[model samples]
Target chain A: MAHLGLRRFPPPLMVLLFLATAAGKEEYGGGSGGLRFRREGGTFKVLQVADMHFGDGRSTPCEDVLPAQQRGCSDLNTTAFLYRVLRAEDPDLVVFTGDNIYGADSSDAAKSMDAAIAPAIAMKLPWAAVLGNHDQEGTLSRESVMRHLVGMKNSLSGLNPEGIKIDGYGNYNLEVGGVEGTLLANKSVLNLYFLDSGDYSTVWWIPGYGWIKASQQAWFRQTSSDLQKRYTTEEPTQKEPAPGLVYFHIPVPEFGSFTASSFTGVKQEGISSPSINSGFFTTMLESGDVKAAFIGHDHINDFCGKLSGIQLCYDGGFGYHAYGKAGWSWRARVVSVQLEKAESGEWRGVKSIKTWKRLDDQHLTTIDSEVLWNRGSNEPQPI
Target chain B: MAHLGLRRFPPPLMVLLFLATAAGKEEYGGGSGGLRFRREGGTFKVLQVADMHFGDGRSTPCEDVLPAQQRGCSDLNTTAFLYRVLRAEDPDLVVFTGDNIYGADSSDAAKSMDAAIAPAIAMKLPWAAVLGNHDQEGTLSRESVMRHLVGMKNSLSGLNPEGIKIDGYGNYNLEVGGVEGTLLANKSVLNLYFLDSGDYSTVWWIPGYGWIKASQQAWFRQTSSDLQKRYTTEEPTQKEPAPGLVYFHIPVPEFGSFTASSFTGVKQEGISSPSINSGFFTTMLESGDVKAAFIGHDHINDFCGKLSGIQLCYDGGFGYHAYGKAGWSWRARVVSVQLEKAESGEWRGVKSIKTWKRLDDQHLTTIDSEVLWNRGSNEPQPI
Candidate 1:
């Protein structure tokens, strides 16, 4: 399944932990480095792994499985699936869209967090994540969990934006740039946003999942505006805003907009969105910068559907420690490309973007491929 | 139960209604005049009648009643209850907080609308309303229902804030001024906001009860800010925003934040709020002008509790056509006094606000009276 020849590292070599540089990433609170297009095709592939729910390694038993498969099955099986997918796809970046660890099942949240992202760390692929509803349930506070994630090797997660007050930790943005040292080297062609959807309802009256607060919405609006300003300022002729891909744990209420027939993949369960419609969808629509938002909370829902021009998708539950449909193979949604527009047709902004999913089966079954957006004449569907 | 001597108009005279002046108020789209505190004690008493669920006269039968009481129990019983409460309380202003008529049951919405508000119209008391989920179910759309209400005699409801783009109709505000002809005759002593908490979810995905949208919240915030600016401009020494009393149909999600012990009255049914939060409560909290919010969707809930700082209360099941407990009496919540602050000794701005409830039984039972807010040192509770 691995296509790229020299660039795609072999699974044997990828699994071995690559020693990190002696230079400290201690002050790297995300967005300082490590996000660029592939040298061969200029493709920036993003693999979204949701709800890993990793726990005490082999001690944790996989839930909702057949009696025969449950013998020695544990969180290690989840790790195996992750490595399998990574080996097959060899993505540029991996985004863990929440519920990275089942905090309730772990005695040490730091270890669980580390173990959950170990596959990405070992592969030395830059990864960013947003904490979900169950992520703060273990021995760590939400702040501690986020801090642990921010310090991990090859991690690009931050403890909220630099000076602003956003609700939960890990609310930050990563700028995926064009090729290094060229005219578009420092310029961001694509932006990836990671926002924590929160642990639980802290508001006594609103008993359920905690929602993205008004403050978070305000922060998003400001960030969106700031990004558009910088993008337009640099290239005055290209007034369009840079395309964005947002990652969060919980789905906004708008996720329920799709019917089974209208969407691409399956919706095995209800979308466990917050009871409160915090108006983030409206903000996104107004911003006109975000192209798609990927989330994970409802484990069985793996569909991708466009609502009011923006795509809302899910990463079908990835961890064996978490409850899943018996025979359903855990899967990952892969965004294959974000083409960088080059000067004078040599190939500079985002040119085209596409996405699909890959199952954890032996063949690494690919399905539900679709074009999210295109700047050229090759757009498959009407946006 | 009647407190004032000569100022309290007799029930019989009140019902006669001095035939509305030939000078047609056909053009009165609210805020053209008429909202002033009574001269006797300078108190602005407001009667909240919720969920009248009126239908085509005597043919409509009541629901959830004992076998004996079921015999001649129809919407007329609800009408009788309204009249009984009105006669006993003799309120200065009446506000119908949604579900004024069961649109599904009514063959003629206009006739039903007239019948539902007949008590207030007949008594010639100034009345305003915010439609509920059931108001547009039968013969007309939400706009038609509100248009009819705005045209009714003695009705103060408007078809939304002037020239604004609020979601539903009947989104408007009323200003209760100081006694006529005085130096403070034009000053707004109290601000009453009447917003239509829509009939159903128009945003396809978020299905349930209709919610107050971001647009409406923005309208409310702007109106609040404008009111504050005017108040401060008029009285530079008084930096405080005008005390606001908001009236709507469905409660915001915050209504569920209270326990039985924390609030007064009974919550017999689940809080029938919209699934989406919409952040109206947060906007109100930030505005600092709203002293209390009165809503009516959940028929059996008559509880009044404070969440954060704002008071959220229900008007009980006032309509026979709607569902209710067999033993519980139909009732109305009353805001008895909005004390006008005096310059030297006599009254001027809103100094204190108090609320209570009255049943439709033979004694016209009054219950759960408390001080909502008081500017003077006389405030009972901490908030």
Candidate 2:
């Protein structure tokens, strides 16, 4: 009798086989709002890689390193850089703040997204993303692009069962709660907001890039209100306000308002034109929950400032395919929220969160490190 | 058979007896954040009675409607006004923003608190409170006063297990999620923040009134952050920011920043002195979750305005004992949040929330009706 493909291996070998198959799988569950990472020593670390532009190297083999004249990247170098950043920071979460692939109508968004984030997926790093202006500029609509990128193995970027109800792609929220026994029970200390700032202006006469529409703003406000109400208790004596950060593709017009002199970091390129003062900045200000708004459109202009009490920031582009100034290296932004015992004698929530840039290289050197917000300070910044 | 002074009456009478005894028992559980009033077709109605100074009527009788010169109140009138408001609006939730009782060393805090909110409690109304400056100025410390009011029948005010860690009295958060087919099996939609803005400041330099301390500010920031992080899903795709409103005893310094002319409706008194700029307003602005701040310190001033993007509001004082201008009416703030289907096509949260003044008389007429934050408008207020 011929043996069927199914064979009864020893229990130990069977377990190893199951493990191997599971390891080969590429998609992870897009969690309910309750997904939590193991809180290491009370802190959850996040690394953000913006504007990967992976498709620029899609046609070239991994061994070929594109020269400066090519105005593109070496896929191998990009992957190596990601590996270095991951090993150096070992962040609990990784965020691709858009432009994971160059929008070539011929390029496959799914393939490019996979190639761009393959290292992270293999490492089983939890990750998320928002779309860049260039993402949907090709044959694929933003929704189609999102479909290709969402719900991959170990990936956290997809329209899910628990996402905010919105028309746009990649509009969602995530939470990181403290470890049990380390912090207050049922409390989430850090929140991350990923929004879709559209590619092209569809609203007629707005001009230039697409803006965050009123519908998206409404979704943000509504979802935000729900989260605050859920985690906070209305017990007559202890009111907690949740703090969060926002990530997106295009910068709000407020970014242009921050002068080079007002900033603390390197500014190798001029700030790109932003969406016409869409009330997104005002919405952020009004919600009173977002501490910093991070963006990726102005990849070469890696600088941040306190604009009306919100830190409007930019992370230098992570892909060589993206434009960069001479002497500037590919870099990523590393944001660390301090989870500690607050003044009220509870190891419950974060009081201070800081951000810095990590050079996407072998050394993984950091620069422009600064406190984003300090709970003890009276002023929004240290002044 | 000596009945031990208790006799078994008819079955119905026995049931009544049990209920009567049960009514007097204290320590109702502060909700675990899932408590929601039946959303009357997608509306969460709240009746907020500000500054109800219900004393024991010890110095005077219930009939004495303390003349303008007198600084105390009539217990009977206060109860009657509450009854009238409740009968007219039939609100889902009642909030005694502050000064529910006039603290008198001779007056029992528990009795006064009960008497003031008795009508709502007897009606089985879900109610909450924040202590006013006068709430602790008498025989009882604020802590002692809180102990009396903490656990009462059908009460939503107490040092709850779900509360943020803080050193103050009456600082908690509440949520009202949409009932999924009449049961709360899903997430919360609306969040209400109840904060204790402290009595007199022990911070020697700041004389006169107390202020929101760094500790409380820190707590607010931390808790707000925690809430946002908890409800927002980080699955690489959907990041929802939570929106919320805040309630407290004294107003922050930012209240004074709004000019008398910029306000609408009633300003019977100069905006009462607010806490010295202790950066609470700055904190709210920085956190980006709180849309409006409701306050009750100034019994005579009942106006709200957009000051630096956050609404600083006051609900006209409710107590007859509290100082009111001649011809000024006793009123409460009626806040309602719209629990409609969001753009995301789900009733997962609230988009627009509005607040208006509800007269405490039988008429229950609304004045100062305004859109606190509309879902469709570009501006927070009606343009």
Candidate 3:
């Protein structure tokens, strides 16, 4: 029963069970003020949540239903919880993993826009979103919903906005809080590779025209080499880029087909399926100083595993009833990372990582203070 | 029951049932080897099919049993039947909608590859494929598989052996039998825009990366105008670009999500969720002269419908069973198009199309050769 011969328990059933359990939990207790950050010495505390399928709450009993409803409800609650958490922690910055929307076409996709911009607009907290699958759907039309989410719109003359650059179809890079990250690029303080995967409309059976396309892969290789050159100096160079973080909506090495065998009656469901660009992810992890990979899609409780010396963390969905009832309800996790100072004063590596799960409660308690924290001798102390 | 809202049957079930019933029972015969040529003819036929989960005979089911099994079997048999049909029709060209392989990461993926490619190679025909959901499941490199199947590679070195001209990022254009098409170009004789839909690992819910970013969209618009100017002639011209055709894997005017809905104490399955770029297909359809679109995803049987004045056809699976037990088999289809001529011998429009289904003698036969020939007055007559 343990292995079940590659046919993991049907995904729909798992989703249902997760939902039933999640229903028993209370709504997020943290109010809009929860996501605030306080200066902790020389470093800042931040939260990272990806693939929140906002506006996906519909009681539909279809194969892909849980993700839909979960996305919608989660987005609203997540926003509310994020506000509360921000107020409580007052982190300096918030880093969103990806999958800001369930999809561009979701009836509730407008909610995603609200989720992404509302917090930053309301509290003036700096937040950045890496483009995910849901964010990339739809034509790049002025009237399309995705266009609005990414702030991509035509000017009065029907020309692209000045600051906006369409980097190779969907790849992009930007800086937040003086720290830079590039999706599919290596050279940055934090190299966040936001990959496209591929379109669902294309042939799923074939291996082209999707995420990790050749062009993107080539760009990634070049960027990695460039980062190595900049960051390998004995002295802390001003031009040197920082470590890297890869973010996407789907998990690499896909868990398995949710409905391949049960619904279709085909025998080779999980056994024959492919894994998401494992080689690419591995290469990046090995080649560059990739601190971590934040991802979503497998909406179970957090599972942190390593591949090729690279740490892979499945940051559970920010959407509906992801893990279980008692899990992080309407809440996302904030990770405060500080650089360690070696005896020589050069940035050695990650000095400390403190994670907080912001939950809703009438009064804040120490239990809700911090869920996970790791600090080294060279790490900065809390204020 | 007739007006059953989405609650009654989820999108997946609706699509599955539609495919099951729509897998027509007509038996297709072989092609008539008569060559017909018209210099000024501007008509050509194209076939579209999607989600051919080939090599599912030995597939292991995912958590969901019925749908997976059914989809697997249907996909495999349907693909086989499609091959037979394509060989019989011997059309001018063939277009693989998408999802040619069941799971690119599966152990049986190699077998699936063999099954899916056998017919295409045997026929010595030219075809193009887009990415699909099931295809993005595993570790099978998309670029490698695409290069093998399409006889083209994404070249970073800027030298293309397939004779296609590639951009710096491996994006390129190809001329299939004299008709120029770009893999991801703004313009071509027929602008074949191959989009990169996100992978299962990074937001499976969304369908595809919307249109080329804003900058690309501008280029697309300008390219459309330029192509029109370069190809269209107010007066009779000796030379002009061929009429346009758009190809990809997913369908447009997005369908509903692939989830489960509560139905009589049992949850019903839905179809795959729509992408944010659902509007892009509509926009492309609205582009004048974009006569038809070929896609593959719903792998039941061949059906053509019109949206926004554009004809859309799903070519059914190349390896799975179709619908009816009587019609169940694996196969592909070929489309032959003949451009209509004006009174002055100038190109006017597409004239006619004929579809052939592949079936064994054990199945029932219903296709009438004479009826097919009669449908198009411009049908090529044997010498």
Each candidate structure's TM-score, on Cα atoms with residue i matched to residue i, is 0.55, 0.46, 0.39
Native A-B interface contacts kept, per candidate: 0.08, 0.00, 0.00
Chain B TM, per prediction: 0.88, 0.81, 0.56
Each model's DockQ?
0.06, 0.02, 0.02
**CA deviation > 4 Å runs, candidate 3:** A1-383, B1-43, B56-83, B103-115, B131-140, B152-229, B233-243, B256-270, B274-279, B282-289, B301-303, B321-336, B346-383
**How do the residues B188-294 of candidate 2 rate in per-residue lDDT, one tens digit apiece?**
44557777777775533234566554445555655566556544642111254446678888877566656668876566666554324445664565555667888
Candidate order (lDDT): 1, 2, 3
Query: Which residue pairs overlap in candidate 1's backbone?
Result: A205-B257, A276-B277, A341-A348, A342-A347, A342-A348, B341-B348, B341-B349
lDDT tens per residue, model 3, A185-255 = 11123334444443332323223222333334434444445544644441233333455555544555522
Residue B120, model 1: Cα distance from true site in angstroms:
26
Whichever of 1 and 3 has more TM-score, that candidate is 1
Worst 10 residues of 3 chain B by lDDT: B26-35
> What C-alpha lDDT do the candidate models reach, one value each?
0.75, 0.65, 0.40
Question: Lowest-scoring 10 consecutive residues by lDDT in candidate 1 chain A?
Answer: A17-26
